[model samples]
Target chain A: MSKHSIIISNISKSYGNIKAVDDISLNVKKGELFGLIGSDGAGKTTLLRILTTLLLSDSGNAQIENFDVKNNYKNIRQIVGYMPGRFSLYEDLSVEENLNFFASIFNTTVAQNYDLIKDVYSYIEPFKKRRAGQLSGGMKQKLALSCALIHKPKVLFLDEPTTGVDAVSRKEFWGMLKNLQKKDITIMVSTPYMDEAGLCDRISLMQNGKFMETDTPENIINKFQKQIYSIKSKNKQKLIKDLRKYKQTYSANIFGQAIHYIDKRNNIKIDELKNHLKSENHIDIEIKAVKPNIEDCFIELMKKEQSAVTNQLKN
Target chain B: MIPIIFIMPVVQLVILVYAANLEMKEINIIVINNDYGSLSRQLTDKFSSSPFFNVSFGNSHKEANSLMKKDKADIIMTIPHNFEKKLIKEKSADIQLLFNAVNGTKAAVAAGYCKNIIFNFNKDIIVNSPKLILEPINYKRINIINQFWYNPQLDYKIYMSTGILVILITIVSLFLSSMNLVREKEIGTIEQINVTPIKKFHFIAGKLIPFLIIALFELAFGLIIAKLLFNLPMSGSLLLLFVVAAIYLIAMLGLGLFISTVTETQQQAMFIAFFFYLVFIMMSGIFTPAESMPEWAQKINYINPVAWFMRVIRMILLKGSGFAQIKNEIFILTGYSITVLSLAVWRYRKTG
Candidate 1:
């Protein structure tokens, strides 16, 4: 068996003239939980679809468990389980029926792999007789996970499983995934939420069908070269406009009630930035340099990407 | 889906049995009585009282002929002048019955009704006057014998029930099979299934087997009810009928699968299936005889599986046709099954 469970090279997929997945490539190691973190339409779903053998990439090759995506698709299908972004299990069927159906299609029974899905199954077992379409969002996710894991697959692909789920369920869902990783299943998940990126072993931050950066969540945060400041004022709306007028300010974006901005001149003192806002009729302003998170890194990288495109167009 | 499977057959059987009546009644007759004798008046009263004929007196024979030509009158009875005198002296009278044969089936039925009325009138004359029996010249000596075989009663309900059973089986199997597949696509479940190691043949069989069983079950259930309700005769072997139905369903199911392959949504599949269903039903010779249709339409029946099944079902149920008699229909249906199933399998793609 190969050490790497998934390998995608030079994959490009286009829908009409819009490049949904443009010249992207990546790999997932065996037993590694990799995250493809991006907002909607960043080609996260498209890339996952290609690796799962549901779609053929426009260019280049993708392999799952050393099997070619195009030729060895049948082999690939045997070892991989995919939970699509949509709630796609048979709605007319009961919870247990849906589980049994997926299990039987893989030529196994739910009893055979009860232990593999017991964690998620416990939440849904009481509603075993209830129709799948009638379940709550959190319960549906649990059911989907249980069905996907029923076959004890070598790899699992989950696309935006936590998008519409509640915060508690989302956290609990990630906890379940971490538990599954101990069994040596290479899990590749995609999400539009930047907060979820920190839960993965490693993540590739994507934008507009291209990988902006790929690294451990902590490492990517460490590589944020620009210093981000958590600035608060009595009036955040006016402060944003005033802060953007500062010559040293590189970017000023709203984050919750406070504003996070990067400085062009690294050596600028806090007092100097404070006085600038104070001069703009801003009172009781607090500015402190803070550690950047993935969302800040994403915004900074997107800016850099856009500027690069503009430069190329200028040339 | 299960409720529909149970309900559709009964509802369709009731509607189809009642609506498919081809029996013509109340044929309008124009009587041109030139003789104002009591005998002519009595004959005219007999024609008017009969349920089959609606009688009206015409001003002249020419007017009655024109009325028949214009389709206003189905029949014209022109009683010649001095008809009573001739019958009394010459022992024979000439009365002409002209029929509009444009609609040949209706015309034939109307003519039969008129003949029965005239025959009854002849019996009355013979009974009233015993002297006429000695000559035996009052009536024409043309002896005509009528024998109706198979469905002797000409019960349209019996024919319609069997025909409708075939249609129900075809439609239910086709719609359910195709709609099942398209629903999977619509709900994105197909993507989940396609990514599995399941072979294409296994996938298609999985889709086909359930609906095939349900459709066949419906056919048996419907046939049993029809037999009980209408006393529908099964002249040929039940095993042979089922064997042919199984083959016929495969063709319809294949058409369904083919439609699913080309359509991405259930609505699209429905519309396309409906289009083909309309063409098949109209040309299946269920309401009209295939022989009465044009030559080109008869040629179209060569490719129509429903038409083949319709004819075969009627033959087996009504005419008691055996396997040898219907071998050609079975062969054609088998050919249709192979072509459609092969096309469906080829068109179903594992990947986009």
Candidate 2:
């Protein structure tokens, strides 16, 4: 077997004029938990679908466990388990029936792979006789994960599995993924939540069908290259407007309770920003430099990419 | 679903069989006695005595004409003045029979009844009075005897109920099978199934077999109803009927799967299935004979599975036909099943 569980080379797919996966290439090593972090319509689902052999690429080739996605799809299908963005299980079937059905389709019994899904299945096991449609959102996610893992697949693809799920369940779901990784199953999960990026071993920040960066979450945050200051005042709405009007402001965005402001000049004084806001009829001003997170890196990279496109258009 | 498969067929069979009758009955007649003579009275008595006609007396042609205008009378018979004297003196007389022709079939049947009654009255007069004959001439008369085959009584229920049974089976199998795969697609479960290692042939067969069994059961139930309720004949072997029905169902189920593959939603599948069903049933010779249809329509019916089954079922049940008599239809259905099922399997795709 190849060292890589999944390999792609310049895979590109387009719908009419819009490119869904634009000249993308990546490699997921054996037993690695890789995350594709991007907002909705960022082509994460499209790329995952192509890798799962459910869609054909307009140009390029991909492989799963050294089997070509086009010519050897049958072999790829045997080793990979895919959970689509929507809850796609039979709603009328009971929880136990859904798990057994997927197991049988793959020519395996649920008892054979019970160890792999024990942690996740235990959450919903008490309601195994209940119909799938009657389960809550979080319970449905657990059942879906259990069914996907029921066949002991070598690789699993989960597309936005945490979307629309409660926060506590989302955390527990990632914990379950960590347990599956320990069993040597390569996992590729996509999510729109930026905080989830820290949960994966290596994360790829994607936007507009392109990957901005692919590295550890800490490394991406450390490479921000510009200092971001979290500024607050009594009037947040007015403070944001004044900050944008400031000549030195490179970008000013409202992040939760404060504004994450970046100056054009790297070497800047905090008093200069404070004075500008102070002059805008502000009171009780607080300004402090804060460490950037994955969301900060993502916004910075997206801004750079947009300016680059505008420059090309000028040329 | 169980009720739809079992109870619906029985309800439809009973309702449609009794509703679609064509036999004529109780025709009303109004008699205008202008002569007030014994012979005219005797003619009126003859019309009243016939089982097919309900006779009433009217004084004048105007009165009977008004009754016909009001739709109260089906036929108005105007007897001429001096009808007995004219017949005795000149051996001829004129009587006008006016019929309400709004319902053309009813009008024609009523006219035929009036002619038979008048003919019988003339024969009675000729037999009773030999002096009225100017000369006795010898002539040879050839009597034609009528015998209706297959349906000796020409029972309309037997013909209609069998055809309706075929329609019932078609609806159960075709609509259900066509909606099955599309329902999966609409609910997004098909994507989950497509990722499995299941082959296309197995998937298609799995969808087809259950509906096929249900449709076959419906056919048997309908046949039993035909035997018990309508007293429909079962001249041919029941086993042969089922074998042909199985082949025919395979063809119908294949067509349904094909429709499912081409459509993305259950509603679309239903519309397409209904369109083909309407065309097939209209040309299936159920209500009208396929032989009498336009030449182009008959040619189109070659591909209509319902038409083939309608003809074969009637032939077997009514004519008591054997395998040799229906071998041609069986072969055609087999070929049709292979072609359509292959098309369905070929059209189904595991990847997009």
Candidate 3:
């Protein structure tokens, strides 16, 4: 087997005038849990589809386990498992029948892969006789995962697996993924939920069919050069407007109950900031230096990329 | 689905059979009996008493002809003056028969009924007259011996129900197979299938096999209902009928799959199937004779699967025709099956 689970080099796909996946390249190491984190319409699903052999890239070289995606698609298909964005199992069939049918299609039996799907299937075992269409969203999700893993595929591609799922179920699904990772299955998952990015061993933040950054979550956060400060006031809405008007304020956005602001300079004078807020008639105010999270790092990267594009347009 | 496979065909066959009759009844006849003799009156009684015609008397041929022109009379029979005297003296009589040939089949059948009545009247006259009977050699009469084979009584239900059964089977299989495949595409389950290691032809075969079994079973079910209800003839081997149905379904299901492959939604598939059903059923000689249609229409039936199946079922059910006689139809259907099925498989894209 190849050392890397998937190698996608310079892939691009377009639909009419819109480019869905544009000049993207990445390599996923064997047994690694890689995540593609992007908002809706960020081309995350498109890239995952191409990697799973369900679609072909217009211009790229993609291989799974060293099998070419175009010429050796059949070979690639045999080695990969895919869970699409939609809950696509046969609804008329009971959960057990759906799993069995998928297993039989790959020329394998459920008994052969019992241990592979044991953990994931356990959650849905009680309702195995219920029709998939009648299952709740979380149960359907677990059933889909069980069916996808039944064949013991080398690589599992999940496109937004936790989307439309409740928070507790989402956490349980990640726990299941963590258990599967112990089995040394290379898993690639995509989601718009930024908090789920920390669960993956590594993640790529994508925007407009291109990757803005790809690294471990800690590395991405540490790469943020700006010092972030959380400011609060009695009137939260007015505080955001007043902070944006500050001369040294570079970026100010509301993050939950506190407004996060970064200055043009690396350091901020607490006394000066207090005086400025006092002059603006902000009462019961509190300000503190806080660490940046994934969302904060994401906003910073987006701002940097936007300014670069603006400069290019101006030139 | 159960209703479509089991109950729908039986209901359509039962209801449509009554509406499918082609036998003509209640033909209006206007008679001008100028002779005013017993012989003319006797012939007039025959027309009125028979169930096939309704008789009306006119004073003269002018009124009779006018009545016919006005569409009141379907036939006009005129007895010439001195008709009884001429028959007694010369041993022959003259009469004029005119018919409205608007519907050619109905007119022809009506004429046959009239000829039978007239021939029987002549026999009665010859048998009753003592002079003619004593000198039997004076008049030479020719009699026609007619025999209707296969269907001695010519029951319309037998022929129509068989044709209807074939059409029902064809439509159900075609519609179900196509809709089944397209439903997957609509619900996005086809994406799951596409990502698997399933072969393209295997997928197509999987779609066809279930409907094929259901269609074949329904065919047998419909045949049983036909036999029980209408006493439909079963002179041919049951195995032969099943064999032909098996081959015919390959062509139908293939065509349905071909339609599904080209269409994106079930609605589109249904519309396209309906278009083909209209063309194929109309031109398949189901309700009308194929020979009576235009030449171009007959040529179009060569490619129509329903036309082939309709012809085969009638031949098998009514005539008890063996497989050797329908070899040409089977061959053509096999060719259609190959061409359409290959196109269906070739056009279906696993990766798009």
lDDT by residue for model 2 over B1-352, one digit each (tens)?
7877778988999998898766666778888777987788878999888888888888887888889899999998888888889988888798998989999877987788888888888777776775567343422256567899999998999999989999998998789989999999999999999988999998998899998999899999998888899899888888999999999999999999999999999999999999999999989999879999889888988999889999999988899888999999999999999999999999999899
Compute the lDDT for candidate 2: 0.91
Estimate the TM-score of every prediction. Answer: 0.90, 0.92, 0.88
Give the whole-model CA lDDT for all candidates, comma-separated. Answer: 0.89, 0.91, 0.90
* Candidate achieving higher TM-score, 2 or 3: 2
lDDT of 1 by residue, B1-352 (tens): 6888889998899877887777776789899889998778878998888877888989887888777777799888889989888876776798998888888888888888778887788777766754454544645567877888998888889888988998899888888877878889999888878877778888888888888888889999899889888999999998999899999999999999999999999899999999989899889988888778999999988888999999999999899999999999999999999999989989998788
Better of 1 and 2 by DockQ: 2
Q: Against the true structure, whose DockQ is highest?
A: 2
Error of 3 at A74 (Å): 1.2
Residue B16 alpha-carbon offset, candidate 3, angstroms: 1.2
Per TM-score, the best of the predicted structures is: 2
Which sequence of candidate numbers ranks them by DockQ, best first? 2, 3, 1
- What is the TM-score, restricted to chain A, for candidate 1? 0.98
* Ten contiguous residues minimizing lDDT sum, candidate 1 chain A: A261-270
Tens-digit per-residue lDDT, A237-257, candidate 3:
999999899998999999999
Rank the models by lDDT, top first. 2, 3, 1
Badly placed stretches (over 4 Å) of model 2 are B26-140
lDDT of 2 by residue, A209-302 (tens): 9899999898999888899999999999999998898989999999999999999998989997788788888999999999999999999999
